[model samples]
Target: MPWTPPLEADALTTLLSKVQQWTPFDGNALLDDVGAVLDDVVPPKEDLDVLAQRLRGHLMQLVNIAVTAEAGDKDPEADRLIRQAHTVRAEAMPDDHRRAVGHLRRLGWTVNELLERLVAANCLREAA
Candidate 1:
């Protein structure tokens, strides 16, 4: 069956797109905030790249949430933003990439849905 992106995934994608053009300092600041949230959920890792990738994944989820909040209106820009986030997330996280592909085979979740949950959980850590 074809993969269906989850609502959360769509939200995160939208959020990321809005912040993609942020200044370097702004991006770093956002990453730091996201990292702090993710640290609470995912185990501490020695590899900075791994940590950054995970944080990026979380940002994607935020985008999905943002998109969903703005739903029911004509927003081609939001759709474009979500797609850009999808591309970045797919390329950045190897573990997630593998899990997403595996999901295709086992029917766990569509790539989009898996990404959404992964992102949502990380985002939730900030709240918790």
Candidate 2:
């Protein structure tokens, strides 16, 4: 049997719930993507804050790279949303896991979408 580390209730709930919603990918493709992103990302019992920060940092960096690769000024509204998500992620909230997952949920749109909207929004902002 493969060893599975314990995960926080809320984080586990969020991950499983999101995975359950993905129907387009056959078999384990969706799970594979999720696994790829979360592989070895076990958070110590008292270090949820650090884990949340690291996850958000990855998302923020992807968003920055996507936004910066565009020509001309970015759209104010799309930029605002991405910035808002970034701001929400910067705080050290008590429900750090839930809040971080929630931000990902809102930002990504679907289980496999994963930052696509933020990138699209940034591109649209540049086009606007």
Candidate 3:
């Protein structure tokens, strides 16, 4: 059966394309701010490494949030971001690369819909 998307075709297309660039590793903005502060201080390698580790820790803390299924009462925008982040992170999985695919399916995105677009995008070698 042909499945209809929750969004208009164009919007869904845009979303699929954008999701490729999304990251579950959050805190990039804060990391940039930390980088700016470090720039002013002319930090040594050890200091910079420490800063990077701290930022990575913060990002790891957010990883679970990114993969969490959206609550029925959650804000739509926030859910969208989390799902996108999860989708991007799914690429790193070994055996089950489609965890985010299942997540999106539960959220009303059909497997065929995603697969059609993904296959058209050449399975990630070239971003859609």
Best by lDDT: 2
My TM-score estimates for the predictions, one after another, are 0.32, 0.37, 0.26
Q: What tens digits encode model 1's per-residue C-alpha lDDT throughout 15-82?
A: 78867945332334444544443433433334435544544545455565646655313445445545
Of candidates 2 and 1, the better by TM-score: 2
Quote model 1's TM-score: 0.32
Each candidate's lDDT (Cα)?
Answer: 0.44, 0.47, 0.39
Task: For candidate 1, give the lDDT of residue 113.
Answer: 38
* TM-score pick, better of 2 and 3: 2
Candidate 1 global lDDT:
0.44
What are the candidates' C-alpha RMSDs?
16.4, 16.7, 17.4
What lDDT tens digits, residue by residue, belong to model 3 across residues 1-128? 99876668889889898788566533345435344433434444334434434433433334343334332124454444444534533433223324422332232222223223332333322112
Which regions of candidate 1 fall more than 4 Å away from where they truly are? 1-46, 71-73, 92-128
Query: Candidate 2, which ten residues in sequence have the lowest lDDT sum?
Result: 25-34
Q: After superposing candidate 2 on the true structure, give the runs of residues whose Cα lies further than 4 Å from its correct spot.
A: 1-47, 71-77, 95-114, 118-128
